[model samples]
Target: MEMLRRWLAAGLWAGTLLVPVHAEEPSVEAGLRVSRIGGCHDCHTQGFAETGGQIDPSMALKGSPVGFMGPWGTTYPTNLLLTVEPMSEDAFLDFAKTLETRPPMPWFNLHYMTEFELRSLFRYIKSLGEPGEPAPEYLAPGETPKTPWIVFAPPQMPE
Candidate 1:
């Protein structure tokens, strides 16, 4: 009986020692949920030609076209998937800090997220593996020149 007890104690101690010491891997789905709510995919993901105007699930959060336009300039959004490369924890923290001072990114508002949430988001992005093909190119300058001087009024107004 004593020998059995000793064996059990040693087994328990060994089991404890073999247990992982680091925190568990962040939940990718949970982080994705938060990102969806946070609108990360809206700006980051490219849309597909589905009947219902669905997002391309294959390209979610993969970043914007380099020259895509909106209210922002000709810059595309960054890929959240960290697939471009593995970002160190410090790099992610620095990126989060940029939200405080950058425009067009709306990072300032996202600054309100807790550090844990931010880390989870980061992990989720990082877990996306690698980036795919580059986004489409922007139109060249003057390729579709604006001829403001030759502007015409509506048909009725012109008449």
Candidate 2:
């Protein structure tokens, strides 16, 4: 019986060694990583997409002037810095979990983010300097957008 117990322990130890370990990155660093890979800069930062991501970091997350026009009307990226600037970490987490917004915002993705990831994101955005101007208001369907906008119309099927 003692010999069997020793063998089982050894097997468990060996199994652990075979498993790959991925340590969680620190909150702010993890947030920054998530932001980059999640494509937050692509729409939230002005010139970020057009410049192929060469824009200054200072300009990031301040919101873009461009609008994405679709069937739901025009939606602009919000100023992330300002959005979370006043929220407590816990409040931000709760807000993220329940966030819902217009088209192209990908607000649904926030519901899947872990608490640690959400906290990290809030910390990272807060670290960026003071907030800038807010994006233009949402335009109802058929309303003309004053700023430069991208039309997200459905593609024509090649019959």
Candidate 3:
């Protein structure tokens, strides 16, 4: 009986070792689809010109306009390419985890993604890493350099 037990344990160990150890990388198209569904490019990339929509493929996910304004005041999205540097499967996992802490970043709600789905998104973002021109500096509200929408108040009548 002891001999049978030993044989069983050995077989189990061998079987475990025989299984493939490497994880498969996702296809670029699959990754893009995930990003699209997650709305990653909406805040990360510059807004579209036509319908003011979010599908600007030419500047897709390249980070927000440098001087762009948002509800949080003047700020730009981080260049995801720089954030995903030294790309590796593990690095991708780390990046996905960061989504939890991101603010005004709606896609971070995807904390429930399976490891495979996260990997797909990471791969797609990494594939778009060509350096782009720097965006212009943004002036804060009430600052000297005014935005196009600034309006001056009229003089008040005597009370």
Ranking by TM-score: 2, 3, 1
Q: Which one is best on lDDT?
A: 2
Off by over 4 Å in 2: 1-26
Q: Per-residue lDDT tens digits of candidate 2, residues 76-112?
A: 9998988987899899999999999988889998899
Using all chains and alpha carbons, the TM-scores for the candidates as numbered come to: 0.55, 0.81, 0.57
Model 1, which residues run further than 4 Å from truth? 1-26, 48-55, 66-72, 82-84, 100-103, 134-159
Q: Relative to the unseen true structure, what is the C-alpha lDDT of residue 117 in candidate 1, on a scale of 0 to 100?
A: 68
lDDT of 1 by residue, 1-159 (tens): 999999999999998887764444556776777787787776677663232345566777887663433322234456666433656866776667665422356777567876666777777777676676654433342343221112122355555
Order the candidate numbers by lDDT, best to worst.
2, 3, 1
Model 1, CA-based lDDT: 0.60
Native-referenced Cα lDDT, model 3: 0.63
The residue pairs in collision within model 1 are: none
Clashes of each: 0, 0, 0
